[model samples]
Target: MNRRIGILISGRGSNMMALVERADGYDVALVASDKPDAPGLAWAKSRGIATFALSPKGIGKAGYEAQIDAALREAGVEIIALAGYMRLLSDDFVARWRGRIVNIHPSLLPRYKGLDTHARAIAAGDAVAGCSVHVVTEELDGGAVLGQAEVPIEPGDTPEILAARVLAAEHALYPRVLKEFVANERPNPA
Candidate 1:
């Protein structure tokens, strides 16, 4: 059986779109966001996928994630994919869903753990910059990497330019990685 996947996003969810375009071994059972006006929810709805959106402000992080947890459970989601979900999940959330949640980071892991990854790469004069797919752990961006795709950083390339390139890499890399991940995780059913 295909994995029942739940995708979480906060913005346009371009990566989520990429995953949807190639959802073969997985079912996108739910598309959810913390921002009620998030564009991705509309896009998901257009694709006939279930969606949930709610405001997190003043709800507290744990409370907000509890709501998300409820949605995921209701949808029978077997896997959680973070496309552009900006909020940090509580430690309890990560632990409950350990090894079942994954995220795509704009930069290679163990470096640029936080935001401004593109600018950080360029400012450091790094010759190569890329993206990584990793297990989501309680420690921010501290998960073990599952896959990576690299692109050379051209001289004087602005963060915007680099970001665009990295995003393209993300679009291509995430779906393939997720497919393989799900397959590897399938049970023997012995």
Candidate 2:
């Protein structure tokens, strides 16, 4: 049987859509979001995938994550994929999932760890900007990189332009890496 993967998103979830579209050897068990109105939720619902959404504004992180954890477990999610999930995950939450959580960051990684990666790369006069698919560790984006896709930075390229290209790379890279990761990480196979 295919592994059950859960995706967390905070916005349009372009990466999540890519994973859904190109899914192989795994099933999207759930699509949960911190932003209740995130467009991705609607898309998942339309596809008949289970979805859960709750804003952390009022309940605080602990309570919010508790609910999300329950929802994920209920849906039998074996893998957690963070796609455009804006909020920083608490250490406790990360501990619960550990190596089971993976993320797609819009940078080659070990170079740009946080946001504004495209602009940072351009500002640094880098020749290429790309995306990375890696394990989600307690330290931000400081996980073992499973894969990367490089997009050459053309002259006069703005962050917006570079971001679009990098995003396309992410769409292509994430699903393939996730498939391999699931195949390799089966310590507790059912």
Q: lDDT of each structure?
A: 0.92, 0.93
Q: Which residue window of length 10 is worst by lDDT in model 1? A: 181-190
Put down candidate 1 lDDT per residue, 60-150, tens digits, no spaces. Answer: 8878888999999899888899999998898999888888899999998888998999999999989999999999999999998999999
RMSD of each: 2.2, 1.2
TM-score of 1: 0.96
lDDT of 2 by residue, 64-103 (tens): 9999999999999999999999999999999998789999
After aligning candidate 2 to the native by TM-score, how far in Å is the CA of 153 from where it should be? 0.4
Deviating ranges (above 4 Å) for candidate 2: 187-190
Clashes of each: 0, 0
Best by TM-score: 2
lDDT of 1 at 180: 88
